[model samples]
Target: MPFMEFVNFYLMPGIVLGSIYALGAVGITLVFGILRFAHLAHGDLATLGAFAALGVVTIFGVSPWVALPVAMVACAFMAIGIDKLFYDYLSERPKIIVVMSSLGIALMLRAVVQVVWGVDTETYTRGIVRPDDYWGIRIRDREIYTIIAMFLIVGVLWAFLQKTKWGKAMRAMSDNPDLALLSGVDNRKITMLTWGIVGVLCAASGFFLGINTELKPLMGWTMLLPMFAAAILGGVGRVEGAVIGGLIVGIAEETSVLFIPGEYKAAMAFAILLLILLVRPTGLLKGKVL
Candidate 1:
């Protein structure tokens, strides 16, 4: 293969993977920003969303594209339920403790998924979309669809955060929860809304990922590190950071294959994360401290 072709193939996978990571990371950052916890269950919540989509596809015999929204709605409901059951009462707890608690929730959720779905790998779409050429580059329909969906969701989310009343309320809560409360912002409602939005985003990301790659019960767990790295790199609580960080991480992972073995691809995000922590712990975008 020519150098350009080789480069394109390497770059494309990274972008697709990074987009998925970015979508998940955005949810993580949002949860962290609004709820003030790490929300470790994010990955599993995403997995749950994927499984929901899988179920939807199975029941309706619908196209993956058609099934996505239904899956996202399931994820949204699950997220709301998780918050209501696990974190709602504990919202006032210490932040670090909440993070650990989130881990516990994550573990329980993972176990529940394993019990419900078993450990077998699953696929959402039976018929694969072959790669098509785009200006001398090759890409799959799933890849194009994922990228388009990501941008659409991100754009809508950005607008919601900036232009809408609820969006402003979310920002206020993220900036200062106590102040928001004093200002008459219902923290409970905001909390539920945040979970809902994050849930939708997580489900969409997981669905795309599962549709592209086979869905294993632990599929979301494997994405945690890269998603975290992307969040931290972009600056926690900053929506743009999550998106850009995901792109950077995705591109870096793909480009690294030029000099490193593919087996090491999983480690690239961690390595970059470590370096960032050492150099600029606040993240590249300088997000406000929680």
Candidate 2:
């Protein structure tokens, strides 16, 4: 293939895919770091966000761009409610129990999507969206929006974690929850805040996915493995690491078509996940290992 062809076909898509995955992975990392369990329902939450945005677009006749924030805020609230209703009660139980509950929650979310949306494949705005060529590299408008939005959101999130008071509390809780609680940090508030952020991130991820591709009830479930792979590859609980890992996995999946069939492209993530587990369990940044 021509070098430019590679850039247009592989590298660009990889970055976009990575950006979407990064949104979800960052949430997964935060959950792992703070709650100390894998949130298996995260992708389903993304699906819910996507479907919620679709509803706004359909009912309000508004552009999906306008509905994005609406869906995010709604999803954030729902996530908080879920935390209070299901996860909070299990707090006294082993963390593993919560993980299983998360899996159950994932199924419930998917069922809701299927019953409401009827498992039909949907899109925000459908048609042939041709890409504009920029110096021999073709790129779609949605692609640009997805990448830019991902950068803006993740950058703002990083800033929040670095410069804000709640961000510090979150970090402290992730590092040592017992000490943080002893220091007078309100554990309940921090937990709620984390879920809120995770819920918003899911909306972002879902919106981008709907924009870049078609929406399906199962799409979010399909993303679960890749999101987890990104989190693991990036290093658990390290925000920057999750971003880097997401990009790597996205690029790897897109480029894998050069040597392997497209059907197995997802295997790339699995390979990376297993490889990281074997060689460097602590991850690239020495993040906490499972």
Tell me, by TM-score, which candidate is best.
2
Clashes of each: 0, 0
TM-score of 2: 0.99
TM-score for each prediction?
A: 0.95, 0.99
CA lDDT of every candidate: 0.86, 0.93
RMSD to truth, every model: 1.5, 0.7
Tens-place lDDT digits, model 2, residues 1-290: 89999999999999999999999999999999998999999999999999999999999999999999999998899899999999999999999999999999999999999999898899999679899999998999889999899889889999999999999999999989999999998999999999999999998998899889989998888888889889988889999999998999999999999999999998999999999999998788778976
Candidate 1 lDDT over 1-290, as tens digits, reads 68767746887888898899889989988987888778788888888888888877888898777888998998899889977887777767777777787788778878877887788988875666778887878888888888888989999999999999999999999988889999999988898899999999999888988977988888888888889899888888999999989988988888887789989988899998898888887788986555
- Give the per-residue Cα lDDT of candidate 1 at 96: 79
